[model samples]
Target chain A: MKPLTTGIAGIALLAVLVLAPLGLPPFAMTLLTEAVILGLFAMSLDLMFGYTRLVSFGHAAAYGLGAYACGWLLLNTGMPMLFAVFAGALLTGIVGLGVGWMCTLATGVSFSMLTLAFAQLLYAISFKWTSVTGGSDGLAGIPRTVGPFGFAALSSKAGFYYFALACLVGGFLACRALVRSPFGAVLRGIRENEAKTTALGYNTRLYKIAVVAVAYGLGGLAGGLYAPFAGFANTELLFWLLSGQVLIMVIVGGAGTLVGPILGAAFFMLMEHQLSAWTEAWALYFGLIFIAFVLFAPEGIWGLATGLATGRFRPASERH
Target chain B: MSTLALLLTQTVNALSQSALLFFLGVGLTLIFGLMRIVNFAHGALYMLGAFVGYSIAAWSGSFWLALAGAPLLVGLFGAGFELTILRRLYRRDAHAFLMVTFGLALVVGEAVRLTWGSDALQVAGPPALSGVVFMLDEPFPVYRLFLVAIGVVVAVAIWQFLERARLGLLIRATSQNADMANALGVDVKMIRSCVFGIGCGLAALGGVLAAPLVTASNGMAATVIIDAFVIVIIGGMGSFLGSLIGALLIGFVQVFGNYYAPDFALAFMYLVMLAVLVMRPGGLLGKEA
Candidate 1:
């Protein structure tokens, strides 16, 4: 898409999101809030998978850690909400740095598997350490606080929705800036040809670890928003299944495009909500759709839309 | 029992667990070796096998029939899936295979839940093997010993088959150099399908054996797939013997870790994997990256 058109679309999307809560019912508002949070989560995965070509099957480890940290802080310390979110993101960023360092040592499927193993370790801890993490029941009764002004009682559906929307927009802009920067160019270079990047005198490993940490920190920020929105953090968030879900969103929306995952997340969340309402066997249908998407439209919905708009279909090789 | 006896019993328990894991890991490695596709649905196939085994045993009152029937059925399904779906994907990005197989896992898991319901189903070991035997002043379940024996025999058989048999030679040749094997008139496509079927069969066989112990349930697929992947990763992705050794290592760690520190048993397993990854990124038997 051209820069002008992209800018217009961004403004239009922002307008819709800003006005959504005023017109929409409380239930739809809640769904939109969750969708935005999940969209940010999917965007973080895209930074690593789409841009860096690092398929992290354990991305949820950082995300869940963020949620758990935020939840624990709110429940135990009674800290201000913004402080809890910052603390959660900081803690997750540190953990991400450590884990991403080990993970960058390998590449390809082995790297994916290693990330998965680390996530599972974290999941095990959360599930077993009942005293601190609330075990399988998860940490509950988290209060929702918004902004530096210390606005409590943002637990109302519309209030939380707007807060989440603000965070999502902020996150999207930050991610867009990061991806368009020179560092993102290096990441793209590494993705296209890591060996070539290394031969070009670039330290690809250091770049990969740095990008991973940044992606994970963003994931943590999303998770921080998630804890207050949901009022609890569960171990399921750390499971590989959640990682797979985000991956599906990235692939189904459009991997390389920044806006694609958000579209994908919104599509998936809405479809899931609608499907489950229609049938209990929603996963079966969802699986079929996922398989069809991978087979037929590997570039995803965003790719399809762009192809239609531009009168040309770019193959996966030529995509961003 | 003395502490020594308890430790011995746990060691025996670990052996049986390792045997079960070997069944899943070896098959996974074989498929990956030949096809270069990580079969995420292998766990779902295992779950299907357990469900099939449960039904067969429940209806016919014959544990032996279920043991033979389940793997055979799932193996055929695996071959069909390869012919229908995976055959078209070989030319695409490797990530496509992972996504499709993961989708298959979701479909299969959901299908299992729909068919069997969400409740766990129990299937007893065969009557003859249900008894207990004293070992090291501890009464160990005879079925577990039988599982260990089966594991050893199967490991030896697999080794012998891969080393000595003509078809096995064809499989090895194809995996080693598919283009060369094709140039030499070997039907590489047929070999790929066959290997995939065998791999799925091996996973199913593990499920059938494990059903009596772990019970047949939808949750089994999730846990077993991760463990199977860990074994394959630690053993070397495509190395058969590496899978066996990796399984044994994981099995011992899990059993001993559970005994000593239940809270950290799973974490300990992952720690070992990380250590191996740091020391040998390709795994113990994996080729250098």
Candidate 2:
């Protein structure tokens, strides 16, 4: 898409999100809040998987850590919401560096397995360590204080909704800037041909680690939002199921496109809500839909939408 | 029991567990070795094996029938899934394969839950082997010893098959370079299909064998897939011998870890995986990509 068009579209979407509360009921407003948060989480993954070619199968570890850390802090301490969220994200980023270092030792399947194992390790910790994590029950009754936003600015439903929307827009811009920068060119370089990137004297491993930390930090940011929004944090967020779902959001949205995952996350949440209401075994149908996307619409929902707009069925195929 | 007796019992316990691990991990490694596909649905195939075995056994009143029938049936389904669904994806990149297989895992897990009602159903061991044997003045389940014995036999058989068999040569050749193998007049497609079948059959066999101990449940696929991959990653993705050794190593780790520190046992297993992963990213016996 043209830069002008993309920018205009982004602004238009932000405006719509800003005006969403005017139409949405309280329940729908809450869902929108969660959807935007999930979109942020999906965007975080796309930074690595879509851009850096680092397909982590254990992304839930970062998000879950963010939620747990943020929840624990909010409950145990008197910190406001914003600070706790960023604090949670920062901790996740630091840990992500360590995890990413080990995971980056191999590429493809091995890297995926390493990430998965590390996530399972965290899951086990959360499952057993009842004193801190609340074991299987998970940390609950977390405060929803918006921190510096004061008691009224970011505490209520509308308050959190605006906060989440602002965060998503902010995150999208930050990621867009990063990807447009020289560092992003290196990530694209690694994605296309890591060996060539390395041959060009770029420390490809270092770049991989950096992207992982950044992506995971953003994932933590989303999780941080989630804990306060949901009024609780739990071990289910740490499961591989969440990782797979977010991955689907990325894939079904359109990998390598910043706006794709956000749209994908929203579409996914709506579908999930609709499908589960119809049948108990919604995952069966959800998996089938995901498979269809992977096979037929590899570029994803965003790709299809743009293709329709541009009179091209396979827009990504003829791109640079 | 004395320390020596306790150690002996634990050793036997580890061996039995390793037997199941070997079946599950070796199948995964074999498919990965030949096709470069991780076969995430292999765990679901294992779960299906147990569920199918449970129903068949209940109907026939024959544990032996279920063991034989389950693998055979599930194996054909695995090959069919490969031929019909996965075959279209061979030209795609590694990530595509990963995601597709992951979708398959989700689909199959849900299917099993729907079919089996999400309950853990017991599949009894064969009456002939259900009895216990006296060991170190302690009674040990004969079925477990049977598991250990069969595992060794299957391990040796598989090793020999890969080393000596003509089909195995085709698989190894394809794994190295499919185009070259095809140029040599090998039916690459058939071999790929058959290997997926055999690999899934092995997983199903493991499931049938494990049903008595763990029971057939909705969560089996999720848990077993992780354990299987842990063994596969530790052993190396495509190495048969690596799978065997990795299975034994993990089996011992889990058995000993549980016996010693029950709370940290799961964490301990992952720690071992992490340590090995950091030290040798390709795994202990896996080739560096």
User: Model 2, B145-208: lDDT tens per residue?
Assistant: 9999999999999888887999877888888899999998999999989999999999999999
In model 2, residue pairs whose N, Cα or C atoms come closer than 3 Å (at least 3 residues apart or on different chains), thus clashing, are A80-A147, A81-A147
i-RMS, each model, one decimal: 1.2, 1.9
CAPRI-style grade of the A/B interface in model 2: medium
Chain B TM, every candidate: 0.98, 0.97
**CAPRI class assigned to model 1:** medium
In candidate 1, clashing pairs total 0
Residues A1-320 of candidate 1: C-alpha lDDT, one tens digit per residue: 67787789789989999989889887888899999999988988898998999999898997899999999988888887878987988888888888889998888878998999899989999989999899999998888755466566555787677767777788788888988999988999998999999999999998888888888888898899899888999999899889878888888888878789989999999989998999999889888988898888988988888788778888776664
Which DockQ value does candidate 2 get? 0.66
Q: Candidate 2, which segments miss by more than 4 Å at Cα?
A: A146-149, A315-320
Per-candidate DockQ values are 0.73, 0.66
